[model samples]
Target chain A: MIQVENLTKKFGNVAAVDGVSFNVENREIVGFLGPNGAGKTTTMRVLTSYLAPTSGRAAVAGFDVVRNSLEARKRIGYLPESVPFYPEMRVREYLSFRAKLKAVPRKQRKQRLDEVMERCRVKDVEHKIIGHLSKGYRQRLGLAEAIIHNPPILILDEPTIGLDPAQIRQTRELIKELGQDKTVILSTHILPEVEMLCNRVIIIHQGKIAIMDTLNNLVKDQKIKLEITGNINDITETLKQLPGIKNISFTQQDLWYVVTIELSNNEDIRDIVYQKIVQNQWGIREFKTERTTLEEMFIRITTRE
Target chain B: MRNIWVLTKKELAIYFYSPLAYVIITAFLLLSGYFFYQFVAGIADATALRYVLEFIGFISLIISPMITMRLLAEEKKSGTLELLMTAPITETQVVVSKYISSLLFFIALIMPTVAYVILLIFWGKPDLGAIICGYLGLICLAGVFLSIGLFVSSFTSNQIVAVIITFVILLIGWVIGWAGEFFREQWWKDIFKYIGFFEHFDAFRKGLIDSRDFLYCFSLIIFFLFLTVRIVESRRWK
Candidate 1:
């Protein structure tokens, strides 16, 4: 339920979120993948109504981010990068304060607070001062505050940034559960977190949307690695003759041939390669096809600088 | 209005839970009380409560900065301003809530000084109207100083910087009248004296409820608060 139209944010001469646009459907989890200073946080801030766009428009839950920021904010929960909190407040008190700030009705604030506390799995530390809690608990508390009002849309900037392995897994599970019912836009540097939690991925680099699509399509489109052993010279020629081959290269050893190919469409080429090897009567020691992971894809897109 | 109340309540809770509030109030009371006691001892008359009120006006200069230095600066330093700004609340509500809550704490700290009023009642029979008017003036004075402090705090994340800037602004506002001495023109001297905070305090101490003086305090409060709102809103654009 979020639509961003040519959103751009400029801090002086720097365009933090350069002309970017995307849409998120109801109950869909969209992962924002980018490297440091890639404008991920800037875009999140624009969507959450925390910062005004230097140009263009955005709407959350059908409310314009500029003209109707208060209404837009009411329908979304945002956990900023780093999750800063009042250190002296107890966990429960802090959530209660955030509940009121979010305008959760007075009659339902306490119940809402309790529900979020449970949802974030922070019920046990309700009374402990937030400053005394560990980093994981603090992150959970930040999440709890974001959802305390039960907004339909969640914009989390790095929800699992500094957590340990266990905490990351727990947070991933919690985000998965959240995505089942609410529209979530998660911005993070961790590729696997995006892979496991998001159905769609939007990769941004240098303040532009480099790629945005379903994970399956992204992998199927860009992932191609060929390992084949045959008459090296003739095999290279045959592979280059293939219709959809993008690039061909071999290691210096020259004993094995590695060809990098980008398919024009989703087509199976394994059978064709097998037939070519048989015709040549060359021993095929290894023949495998592997797709690129999100990590590799991210590196490829961001490192193109 | 509801959001303002919620924020005010949260701010008040913070004031009580943190040591800063207690320390400021205790120090204020002890210092004001000592001065009040000494004034009575030297004058050997309880009627000198007016002098005590005048002196506490100066005490407000110090305590106002202490109460307000952390209002917005601490939020920026800790990054909680992002949370508050992202919530469904307007900038005016945030500024007003913070201003009122700090003023309330200042009032509460000064409330204990009512015992001093009772002391005057039993000993020297101070003018009840003048005493009441003086307390009203002190509250308004605190309101003006707190607004200045809040506005200054919004400019920087460093609490020390906020406090130092606030003190300097308050000192300028306090001493603008003296600068009139250098000018030979009556109009310039009159202008400086009119802008002085102490000039307004003098009207309240005389037990006269002038709307002009009330407007002066109200306009100063609104002006600084509006400046605070602009500063906060400008950050989002940046």
Candidate 2:
């Protein structure tokens, strides 16, 4: 439902979002993963039509963001990074106002207000002043405000930033439910959040997209770890001769030797390695294949040149 | 149009929700009330609300800034401008809604002073035509001042700065007509006389519904509102 091509947004001489392009299909949950000042917020701002791109173009739901900003914005429900609000307003009042601003039909306004308040778990605080609410409630109130109008596309900047662990889990579950039908592009610093919530992950660094791939494909690379009480040289030499063995490193942990093996491909060579170890008559202590987590991959991608 | 109403309603609610509106309104009423009493008791021919209206107009010079300072400045300061701008509304709608809300609050601020007119009618013969014209003039003058204040508030995130700058600008607009007397040249005189707010307002005080006065105030209102819209739109580009 969203398409961007070579989009570059520069603030004065500094480029906040530089030459990035991605498309999100309907009913897809795309997580924007990046560290601070990595252009995640900036990209979302451009998509929401809050900031005009310095160069290139972006369109939302078939409307150009700059030229048809009103139409494009109409389809997007954005929760800005800081979750700003008029503190004097009651939670219910604020949501009602936002619903009106988003052009929610008069007939459904009350129902929608209640629905979002319940879904975001801010129903108890609906009558309370926003300024008096705690950070977690305020964050949920922001989420309620975003979805009050039932927009098809949601661009949330760190939606679960301030919530507690249980609240975070609840919000993750809520987002997962919403992503079943809506196109969601949420930026967050939590790696597990992305792994659990996103179908595809886009890692942006230095205002450019570092890597974009499905969650499964990105974490498909595996590593083998083994602990064997045997001659380190002989074990290394035997492992090197096996096909699909990219590289191997060994570290001594007291009497146990910890060997980490990098596989050349997404291949299971455990049986071959087992036979080789048996042939060598090495005492096997531990053996397992570890699928690389998004955290490790994210650090490797972002920190690498 | 519905969006404008929605925003205006929210803006007005914000005014009532904060202490700023009550404080300014109460202060204005107390000050205006004291002056109204002084004008009525001190002058024998207190048959007209002319002086009182003028006093209210002058009081608005100070009160308009307070009314408008937070209209846009607070939104920018609190980051709610992002929510408003990202909504399906144009900058013009946002500016117009803010202007309308402040104007409504300004009207509410002056609504209590109508008792002075009633007092005059009960005690003496008062020209209702002139009185009506005076109120019309006040509304138009308020339109001009509040628009200027909204325009000033648009660019700044600091409420105090917005109020001070708006007051300064309105003061200049108010005093420029007096400067016209110092200009001996007819061209310079007309320019100052045309731009100054005092001249336009004086005509309404004298019960003359001259189109020139209405045009000048309305044009100023439209000009400032247009400028505010441009500033709001420029935010995206910035």
Candidate 3:
């Protein structure tokens, strides 16, 4: 339940987020994919009411971010890029304080603190001072602080940045669990994370939204890569006659020729292709379908003018 | 109001949990105690804290910046300002809570000096009216200096720079009254005398409850606190 229209935030002469527009529906896990300095964090800060947009409007839960900032901020749980914390405070003490600041009911404050600590996996370090916490623990603590109030909207900027691989997977699972009920907008440069976690992806480049679509639609072009030993002309002629084949290209890999066949639709034509290969008595080594990856699409979108 | 209290409690906890508050408070008490003993020994039978309170005011003028330097600056440097400002709290709440916590710690710093007042009462017939006024004057002076320090701290992320610049500003506010003596024009003299922070404390120090001095002290506090709030609010625009 967030709406942003023509949002542009300028820091002096340079615009960090220029003419960016996007909306996120309730319970939709949307990933913001962009390289560094691509206005992902700036967009998030504006939504969280941390930075006032220079021009245009953003509303959260039906409240304007600037005019009704308190109400708007009340619905948002933001985890900033760096995950800042007061180092002297013990982890449990800090979460309680954050819960109070977020206006969690006093009766539920303790329970909420424990719940977030467990969900974020910072319970083991709850008694230790934050300054002494490892980076992964501190990052999780930041996540705990964010959801302490159990806000309906979450704006996480690189929530998995500093975590180890196992921690990253855990955080992804946590975000996925949170996303089942909350509207989540997470930004990251990691393409695979978005592919695994997000239903919708928004790619921003140079302070502008390059593309926004469902993950499936963005990577819809599928191709079959086949490694076979046969007469190159005969293999190409046989693949061209297939019903769903859109295009074919070949590359030589030593003695074997690698054939890339683009498909016209989302269909399994491997059985027919196998039959034709068997009838021709050609030796096939590799035959697998490959969807156009978000990584390749992300590079293409961000690197283009 | 609830948000203000929550933030104020957090701010107070930060002060006590760290060694900075203890070190500064102990140093202030030692310096004030040494000065009080010297003043009493020199006078043979000192009955009034007139000079002692004045010296203590000067010491607070120098010590106050240390208390407030990290209030806003450290938040900015450590990027915690993002967390603080994004919370569902107003700028007034944040600024008021920071001002109140530092004011409370400052009060704690001066509370032990009440023992000096008690000792005076025990040994000799001290002018209770002048001593009360002197202590009130110290509190009001602190309100002025601490507010200014909070205002200065809002401008920089560097704590050392915050302290130095705040010290310079408070020193100027303290000594600006001397400029009045150099001016031949009556208007120039009156302007300096009215604006000088120390000049307002003189009436309270002499046991006279002048409403003009009270108004001046309050107006300065309100002005600086208002400025600090505006500075915090301006952050979002940038």
Top DockQ hit: 2
Where is the poorest 10-residue window by lDDT in model 3 chain A? A296-305
C-alpha lDDT of all candidate models, in order: 0.88, 0.92, 0.92
Decoy 3 TM-score against native: 0.97
Per-residue lDDT of A228-300 in model 3, one digit per residue for the tens? Answer: 9989999999989998889999999887999999998877888999999999999999999899999999989
Candidate 2 per-residue lDDT, tens place, B1-238, comes to 9889999999999999989888998899899899988888887474447888888899999999999999999999999999988999999999999999999999998999888888888888788999899999999999999999999999999999999999999999999988978878999989998999998898898789999999999888999999999998898888
Order by DockQ, highest first: 2, 3, 1
Off by over 4 Å in 1: A221-264, A267-287
**Model 3 segments beyond 4 Å from truth?**
A252-255, A279-281, B44-47
**Which residue pairs clash in candidate 1?**
none
By DockQ, is 2 or 3 better? 2
- What's the lDDT for residue A87 in model 1? 89
DockQ of each: 0.80, 0.91, 0.89
